[model samples]
Target: MVAPLSAWPWENFGRFKYLLYGPFLAKVVRSRFQEDGPEDSNWCLHILIICALRGLIHQLWSSYSNMLFLKRNRRIVHQGVDFKQIDMEWDWDNFIILQALIASIACYIFPFLENLPLWNTKGFIALLTLHMAVSEPLYYWMHRCFHGNHLFTHYHYLHHSSPVPQPFTAGNATLLEHLVLTGIIGIPILGASLMGYGSISMIYAYVLIFDFLRCLGHCNVEVVPYQIFETIPFLRYLIYTPTYHSLHHQDMRTNFCLFMPLFDSFWKTLNGKSWELHKKISSNLGKSARVPDFVFLAHVVDVSAALHAPFVFRSFAAMPFSTNLLLIPLWPGTLSVVLMMWAWSKTFVYSFYQLRGRLHQTWVVPRCGFQYFLPFASEGINKHIEQAILRADKLGVKVISLAALNKNEALNGGGTLFVNNHPNLKVRVVHGNTLTAAVILNDLPKDVEEVFLTGATSKLGRAIALYLCRRRVRVLMLTTSGERFQKVQKEAPMDCQSNLVQVTKHQAARNCKTWIVGKWITPRQQSWAPRGTHFHQFVVPPILPIRRDCIYSDLAAMRLPDDVQELGCCEYTMERGVVHACHAGGVVHLLEGWTHHEVGAIDVDRIDLVWDSALKHGIRPVSSTKAKTSQ
Candidate 1:
């Protein structure tokens, strides 16, 4: 049986009115024969074209608008929003095609009944009122259901994946989820038509308006004027703005309603910060914005202390619990147990902080200790380093300095693994070893004709050795392996190798005037140095203590200027207070906006330039020797 025309008051319009409703009339005539059955190819095709066109238009308009706004006022743009996520991939393209097909099929089956005189004012009002009254309640529940743990993981999580929602993200959903959403909107229109309360014109208008609002809600950019809501308090309840919808994406538990906040308010799921966030974003309209420049310094944890204390405490406690149970006094046994408990407690607390991914902020730069022990290039250490990089990226940090172990882990290709793994990451990673080498080389005493270089196999160690050799200083290379030492000597220039003297024994370094310990030097090794020898300890998590007779210095520290120095909240210490030369390299790169600098081995000639850039950003190097001497 044929579906009857919608018996609305607007249907009373004469045939002449059909000119104003040409598309609807044409659809009606084309759909007449297939009305006897549910299957209507002509009606389905028309609906598909309409929906596709609507989607296309929304995409084009939103993209154009975003480009214009970004060019004019970039500061107002959401920093967290990675536009790379919005690019159409194979899966996204397939999902969009499926959604369009499903929506078209659903629309043809539960079609909005036709009516004449398309522009009747009374009918339009009634249609919108019924649509809102029905759709809002249904959508609110459906959306809430989508947020349920099981459903969200399987279906709705895709849509919420973009923390900063964009216009394209509005329709990015699973096929079943999209069908449910489309049904919520289409059902109300169909019900209005079935009840003879809606004209074809009214249904068309609702669909167009709904599509427009849907796009606006997910645009990330807040377009609603703050004055409108302040002037008309009730309007907030009636209309859901872009900021209102963005909060829903950020936090799925609240703001469930699609178009209006009436249901959300009644249900008390409305986000409290929605209005505040909206106002904050709105205030940035038309303002110029730029990404803030900052450096992320990855610090090393004292692994030897962490490892040794635990082992010693465990051994001491074991004596009490085992063979020494009878030999040891009761007080000694109790003390050993107490010490073990304290050591384990400390380790547990420190481990908790590491797992928490806490970032320590300084006046000029941010630091995060990987909280791992030395020999930092293991799989476990690399994982933590990756986490640190990810954390830096999330903080909107533009550049990251791989300090200490971090540099070793990222040394080969300069964090190429991280760069490859995290394609969406905007933060640049640097090994900063070049600048560290520069600082050490520049500070080398001119009078010292001979220098002992240890850990020559390492990237930083080799770089420093070559730099010293270039300065015509005689280099005594000390390492555990004689073969590796010879390999390092072979790789150096003829003139550099001519000055290199490989020494397998630590005692061989005694006669050297300057001891440049790059890495792998323990306190025992440090003791091998003769009294009054100039000792430069460059390894992070410094293994050697300050000696009264020896001239001891750590890595060169960055000195901050007076004005910008006040910006950081944390105080600097000799060990932690001064930024390492490696970290300063990254800070300079960020401040200069130079993306192409070689991270692992920065040009030695650029040392002064990098140092100047660091100073410009308020980072100055304090003498490590001076700081140690005062202590």
Candidate 2:
């Protein structure tokens, strides 16, 4: 439980804490518009810009540090950041807002601070000197004091609570700790100002460098090459590396320096293995990569959805995904990134988690979902998927599951094209449609006699229809092609074939309570279902809920078993710890050690087998509420 005094005043405000800056923004706007404004000359505006810049710096570092492609071998912490840590560090920049408010008040009270010049060499030098002489030592000792029994429990424990530190960890602290940090940080700027030499540039330079070093230390990736320290032995003591600070988190008694290790050396508190461990880690940076036992191959949904990738926004990706105002400004840059990915056209690892000591990773194709629907994009999309499958085979991956449109029948024939092209391949290619069909099938009440199926001729649709008919349940297969419908109908037993009925319009399902939706449906089409009808969806970008009186299920998904570890990211809009059914299908395949390639059309015979195997392995459905609502 949090001590009431240690918690931030706006702790419960969540994303709305940005509103704390509203007053400062309103004042700046008033100053700009009013004819007789306080002549501070937009200093407040400059402060806001600098604050934003600091936030951007932290965001960039978080993205870069978590990028598995860039520095997999050099990652100091092998585990991913979980939702709990993301929430704890969500308000990492609260101090920046608090300081901005304080600075605004200060400018109002002080006269000489009205219109400082842009640059002052003397002030810059003075602040740097003060930082080295006064700030560093004071922070070193204060940081050590926080490690003591009393303060550690009361305040500093919050900082160390993040076992796998990221850039934001630098500023995630209790309110009391932040207050001390604010004072420690302000010393140099105030000292410079008091000594009659201060400039806007100096202020910017000092605070940026301070934040840069702080984030650098906490970023779990080892970025600074070891050669720099070896070349100048003195510089080793003068500056601290990311590895040096990571050691402090590992063993709290050593390496308590701020940005400089000189203070730690003076007190014999520096860890001896810092240099050696850093060199060992840095030497292996790009020479090797981690090979996973299972890989779930996925594609982007759209430009906005791409931002939810693990490497983009840590906090946004940790939660059940949604479109919010935060994504609007990032759209243009993300669109550029998407275009670049298309040009590059390579598969890259997106995120990973471990279950029972086996590694499971999600790798993404460069193509978006909409691109797969285009006539010309099919060849390029297949090329990327094929290359990814071949790459996984070469890397000794055990099983690779195709997700979303990556396994589309029109695109790669449900991943059969690649498997047939490379018969000698050892890795199993799975479309995961077996488990997908099973999830959607099992979600219906066991007594559900009739289910209206759309997209009835598609791979999943065909499998679902055959499986239900074999159970002697009535299946309304909605498809325009009678030939395709007959093809699926023949797959069922002769006695059960009579249970499968062909329907050309949604009007046929008006009386059915269990509607299995396999294709996109508009409000008009959906209105055909009766008032209590439950819409079980296997569609991409799930259909909107237009019927307030009806229930709508999320896309087929399963919650991972409790033994899974480091599962920090939600799969698309799935809730935390839950993954799309196909992704879970791949996981089940790996666990069962099933040698057969599960591509092409799903086997109706194995639907019950796969569903039972998934249950045995503890992968379960999304909760009733999560499955029943679009949220």
Candidate 3:
């Protein structure tokens, strides 16, 4: 018997439509058959084909718009224009191939399902309501499971490996992962069908909506209209945006949802960065400005000893009578003095001194010295550094170099904490240790085949030892920990490891011909060195006293250009003849616009580059003899 028209039976009959029509012309035949069938017949095949076409068109449109956004705002976008590289294109191509395969499978299975009436608008709405209710919670838990250690390493890691995702990256996953993801979307629709709430038309609409939202999430460009959320503040919790999903790829610890932020919000997993990123992108909408070339130097005044000094006390006493003083008394005056010191730390660009090549501007951020190097002050000091970085970001500075104690705190993965915490930040933080190591390496005398390096476990100390070993120089490393020494020895090249000798006793260094004193070394310890030994001091405060018997020099000094007589800070007086190597490293990085972090020991080859760039900016290295003669 013929299936009843009221039950919308044409969906079951479509299985034969394929056999009756030619393989290449099946779509045309299906459309003609649907037109000739009863008015209420379920056009299942036609609906599936329409959904596929809609998804394809929407993906192409969204991808084009995303590309335009990235191109126009390349400077603010993470990973910059590297998204257009050939390797990324290869990744996109693989994703498209897999997605096409999945679409083909869906088309094959859809024709066999029971059909509901095609014209039932009420059923379509009910189906969508049911799908949302059942799918979101299930998808949330499934997504969390994907982030678990085992699953993340085996299944979900490929999708997260790319820091900056693009539209095509949405479907880029392992075959098994794609199947599971597909089931998460499909099971709810199948359940709705079993409950007698959906039709072929509802299925088509859902698929189109799902694919569009997925592409939007991975587009890597902020396309949400800022005014909509601003007008209705609650809408932010209701809808998900590209920047929202980008943070998931950035930190991987929060922001897990398909199209709604409801689950993430309820679970307290929504990233705070989402709102900040939205504000940042919204403020600069439609403007494609390049990040200006500027270097930020973060330094602190000598506040550790400021309170007891007569000069500091006098300065505070004079502050209350100054024309700029706000009329706050006693306790407020004390608070005001502290606030004034912080205000003086504001970042300002130095454009007068020109660096050779493409760099010219330098921004200085002078933090209060009391916050650094003291016990229990790290948290406070880090906060100050965060504020400085944020201010530098406002100035469109691309690279920030942490000076002295700042570098010491930011060595290794310390800077990564700041990057992860401030997702809206586009500025790169560099410790500038590499260039500092290069400067010290350049000053070592050629006659010194064997040298003793104190604090060899420190970042700069280890770097110096490695650089010396690479140059075939024998290095005697003095450190407190044997385990650290073994680790460093193992990391060195096998040939170089033999030349590296670890000495636990500080007195053993006295037998060496030369000494490289790291920041950890004190002045009292230097007296133990042999009388005629050459001492190269790398610490900031000049720990070693000038002894008549030893040849002492600070390797951290750089020569200024011939035309420029001296470098001086308006706030404080700097020592004559040379500046600290860390400060000079910031200058070199700024001149070259090198935004990459320079944390470890820099190669010897880079010394020339830094030197040449310094010259371009009109900076040079003064020979020890010349510096002494000039003094």
By TM-score, the best candidate is 2
**TM, every model:** 0.43, 0.95, 0.44
Per-residue lDDT of 555-622 in model 2, one digit per residue for the tens?
A: 88898998888888898888899998999999999999999999898888899999999999999977
Cα lDDT tens digits for candidate 1, 1-631? 3122212122335434324334534555666755553344455454555655666656554443344213224213333322234332112323334444554555556554322345656667667777678788888998899788977777777677755465656766666676676677667666666666656566567777877888888766667888899999899989988888877877778999988998899999999998887777777654444323454443323222222111122222112122334334444554454445334321110100000122222111112234333345345545656776676677576676665655554333556677778778777777766667767776777676888887766676776666666668888887778787777677667866888777788898777758888665777777787777777767664555656567777556664434332121111233323456765676566667777534544454666566566656666666767323323
Question: What's the lDDT for all of these models?
Answer: 0.58, 0.87, 0.59
Best by lDDT: 2
Model 2 misplaced stretches (Cα beyond 4 Å): 1-5, 105-110, 286-289, 624-631
Q: What's the C-alpha lDDT at position 477 in model 2?
A: 90
| Cα RMSD for predicted model 3 | 25.0
The worst-scoring run of ten residues by lDDT in candidate 1 lies at 347-356
Q: Residue 375 in model 3: shift from native, Å?
A: 3.8
Model 3 TM:
0.44
- Model 1 has an lDDT value of 0.58
The residue pairs found clashing in candidate 3 are 355-617, 356-616, 356-617, 559-620
Clashes of each: 13, 0, 4
For every candidate in turn, the CA RMSD to the true structure comes to 24.0, 2.3, 25.0
